[model samples]
Target chain A: MKRIKKLDTPPRFISWCAVGGYEEKNGPLGEAFDLCDESDTFGQKTWEMSEGEMGRCALNLALSKCSLSHETLELLVAGDLQNQCVASSVGLDSFGAPFLGIYGACSTCTEALLILSSMIESGAVTTGACVTTSHNSAAERQFRTPLEYGGQRSPSAQWTSTAAGSFVLTSDEELIKNAKLSNVAISDFMIGRIVDGATADGSNMGAAMSFAAAESIIEYFKESELKPRDFDYIVTGDLGKVGTSILRAILEERLPSAAGKHLDCGNLLYDAKRQDVHAGASGCGTSASVLASYFLPRLEEGEIRDILFLSTGALMSPSSVLQGNTIKGIAPVIHIHSSAD
Target chain B: MDIYTNEGKKEIIKKFTPKTKVLKNTLLAFIFGGLISLGAELLREAYIYFGMSEKDALTLVGVTLILLASLLTALGLFDRIARYAGAGTLVPITGFSNSVTSQALDAKSEGLILGVGAKIFTVAGPVILYGIASGVLYGIIYFIYLYIIR
Candidate 1:
């Protein structure tokens, strides 16, 4: 295999696990998740604490699945939608590995994976875990109004998934041999740029993020010298129904042939017609959980060979929104290949 | 085709923006607002039954509702109630109280005087200023109409 030298050598997945709350567990992809709690609060005191617990549970599940202890893990790279990524920090605090807290909003799952893979390729860490989480109550309270407030939701608004996904990566061949493996490897990645669509409305996240996803996908195709048909699926992170439509339209103009392969994690995360989620599911966990529960397993089973995982994020804070700053969108793409391919 | 252009970007974004559910929201507002008003009326009647005058009972009811709204906002319950109630929760005096209290709570992390104290009126500040101004203007007009005309 010819490796993209700039991106680094591909890192293989040792084990991955997805854990979700009640709403996500009841969704279409519910059966695919490794673990789920019936309660949104997960017996925690606050919604933030519940999110933290979900992250911790995902990491623990991933670690136990690989039969590796927390101390044996080289590093833990994780993030969440909460301010300061407190969910990840507090959730993974018990683990002995060095921690790197990152914030990419809803796209944090891919961002964490990209960083972990790069570290593995650099030979800096032989084994590392990437985790991302989001909670509905925590996100709602921070971004908009509290869930208790009877605020009318806009049709374009997405329900933040109360979920967490964790992936453990190992560069050591010996470790991979002993572990139950998915045989899915991260072959390459393209860091996305902040693309502003000149949108100032915080509620319209789909519009804010669609342009960035389209721009990044086009860039990935150009940089990899591959067409959209090259991958079995080109999955985007957290662009809901409306955002996906917007992205499809943009791609039709920019990369006309590639538009057909486009799929959005947000749109696919929930049953929109049955579920109250008007646009679709969003938040970092939306993409993370879907990948961990659905696509990663499909890759493992050789049902799919090559897939482009493009996670998009709206890099905006409540404070920034309050200050009238436009929401800047970002989308980072990672190429995942199954060993069978 | 170049979505990077201002016009193209705007056009595409507009297509994806979902419209507000005005009908459902209005219905919710009406129901919730009516319930809150009913509660206020009940409180006013209770105060009158306890030997308070009608005018004093009305004043007391308004203050009590404001206090209840502020308490609910602090407890983080008001927002959740407001979600389903929509303008129902917002159209009443309690809604105004919630706005002020919620902003103050949000800004509480910044510090006392600079944060909560300064930001407490962010949403309600304009309403208070305008409300007092209009009240004064109407009072002067009424005075002119009664005394000067007589």
Candidate 2:
């Protein structure tokens, strides 16, 4: 593979939006979301269909915010926690853009963004959208047991956030100027390697993904010759409270000064005490929705200048777990900087 | 960070892992299970009032509850109820029925014989097999006792 380096001309996020189910909307960051459907089903027959509807809803919101139509979108890169990324495919089918369906498990948000930004930087597409979604019931049925099973959740297990988040990005300066939107550029990114923590227990996903998050951060710092303190904030995707602590200890050993700035999207997405979320929020939407609802706006308002957004994913299928294979994890990092910086 | 070493990684993972809430979960299960049993008793009493014998009422109530659970599972409502009710739903016969029906429904797409037919018993098959085995064992023991007494 070619050496990973910072982009020569970073692609800017022109607009973004997050839509979530009732539970997430009532959570701590609830008010920060762009839209919240009162019904988890989104008026769909099945939970999977509802998840698809969420993706469509988020994409529509982002497009509307930018005053752009589906026709104006050059490409659509999206994924969900479902097999074959069916949610994204079915959800965004109406949009008349070339679709690139990618999957990185729950880390799909940052992974999709990485791909979208790279395409724009390569001059392949001037405008594209990165979308990802996850539904609690749908994911539970697919990854673990059906909801009716009433299986006890391990304390280490995270509650999947029922949400979808989309970002409209562009290399065109005119799009931003016309829309009168502040630019949030994708400054740099590091694609993580699949790191196995040798964990066989799927319930302890936080432990499984923590090593991947730490490795990605270390690799990014080494390649860029930057310290953790260099970024205004270093946020990880879906590594809940426990995973965050593990990540912190790992980072502190190598980059002690920067470890303190670390925050986890999963931990920040909900209030653990008030909410029944044992290990806090997770899924692709955990990071995607949080970034769209909270951090992206903060970046746009210049409240934060630079961010190292690392979305970690535990890549395991039900069959893999059944076969006694250990869970392997990957975390893709995206460096987003405000134009004001 | 040479922490990628096996021992170092294990230590980091262990340090951050949270303890399971055994007390809370057990309490939830106990409460829910009690509620389900209470509901069953109420149903049985209502059946008795309608002139059915006590034994018949009890048998009818169990069948009625199982049927109701399966219907709810089909409508995609039982799972939602189960989420909140937790162990309350799982400890009852209704929970067992829901598990069977839901798995069958999930496998419907794979076709009747190979999919739903095969997978319908995936969760409940062991319980059913053991239930029959124990019932036959009790019958044999009772017969032997009667023969010895005679």
Candidate 3:
């Protein structure tokens, strides 16, 4: 590890950005959230979009902003929180990018970014797009019983924010140079460990995300060999308030003495119980949508540096959990570069 | 603004460039759509908190969902959710609304009975057909495999 004060950012990580969402008022997310419903009082606003339409909107947004034709992309790797990658199916139909539907639960965005950046960085591929979107309505139907079925939620549960978000990543030199996002560091650590067949009831996502987030954060520290204060921010996936506290307490209990600033997408998205969001944010799209609304601009503005983004995912299987199979979690960190020459 | 398929409205706004309008002038769309699902959950919780049976809760949730769905479709709110939330908002019951309206509107262009009455059933028709067909296929396959194995 050479101590280079101000390392010149790499040419490898240059990507374009595009956003679409239903407008919200007075909230950071409101400005960037892509809308699908106006009457939906809870987060499933976009429930009217067929899986394909949502993806198409996101892809078109990315295309329009990047000014890249559909033919320009070598491959479009994307996924969604919908069961069996249904949303990705929608984006796949029209976008014509070679499709890759991924489901690492809510970690889909970071996961897509991981693979896309690696492909571009290593020169295995070029001019690729990595995107993921979560439609609130689609998710509610699949995970919870039908919205019409009106199901009870536990205190530990987090409401799914009605939103869809996406980003396009590439190794194109021109875009990176022009946009002023120079250096890029994709964290080499992939939290691929499972809980050795430990079973837990995770009907509510907070508990599930908490366990996974805790493991990844702890291991990221060990793997990167850096303290909490090394980076300006450590953003976790949508672990709303309760899970945020549980995760921090777990970390505190684990380290007993570690300290610094830590935030979760769920906690940062809104004012906990009082604001509309919820107690513990849990969803594959949670981190992605919120980050698009909040984090992306900050990176471009040079307000932050070296974001140690640990996107967390909880892998729960239908038979595995009921038949007493263990739940697994993965958290992969990437170093985001937003500085210029 | 009907989202699931192409509509005459899209033709009317063929040159409208909804990208900016869709992105800009729709705060209520974002807030209400985002919160609607949460509201459903909260309603369910309110029911359960009063010790409503899970079966009863399920019924209440269903009624609430359909009512929301009907209200949303009637007020044209579902279109906004479809635009903003993308699949995020559209994945749930609001989708059912769109399905009904999309088919009905399409059928209206044809005629009442054949169009509205006949076409409406077309909604989820393929899904049900495929589901049943697949189930039968699986049943046959399972029986054959069981016989072969035994």
- CA deviation > 4 Å runs, candidate 1: A1-8, B27-53, B56-85, B97-150
Question: What local lDDT score does residue A201 receive in model 1, on the 0 to 100 scale?
Answer: 77
| Preferred candidate (DockQ higher): 1 or 2 | 1
State the lDDT of candidate 2 residue by residue for A133-185, as single tens digits.
99998998788765555455778889999999999999887887886565689
Each candidate's B-chain TM-score, in sequence, is 0.87, 0.80, 0.55
DockQ scores of the candidates: 0.43, 0.41, 0.02
Query: Candidate 1's error at B121, in angstroms?
Result: 7.2
On lDDT, the candidate that comes out on top is 2
Off by over 4 Å in 2: A1-3, B6-8, B27-58, B64-89, B101-122, B129-150
Q: Could you arrange the candidates by lDDT from highest to lowest? A: 2, 1, 3
What TM-score should be assigned to candidate 1? 0.86
Candidate 1 C-alpha lDDT tens digits along A1-341: 32233445578888889999888888899898999898787778777889999999999999898898998788899999999899998898989789999999888988899998889888999889999999998898778863444356777888999988999988887887787784889988877788985677777788889888888888777767777888898999888988888988888877887788888888877898888888898999989999999899999988998898988899998888878887899988888999854
Candidate 1 vs candidate 3: the TM-score winner is 1
- For candidate 1, the per-residue lDDT at A307 reads 90
- CAPRI-style docking class of model 1 based on DockQ: acceptable
Model 3: per-residue lDDT, tens digit, B49-144?
Answer: 999997898789868876666676556565545544554454456655565655565445457987678867455466558879999999999998
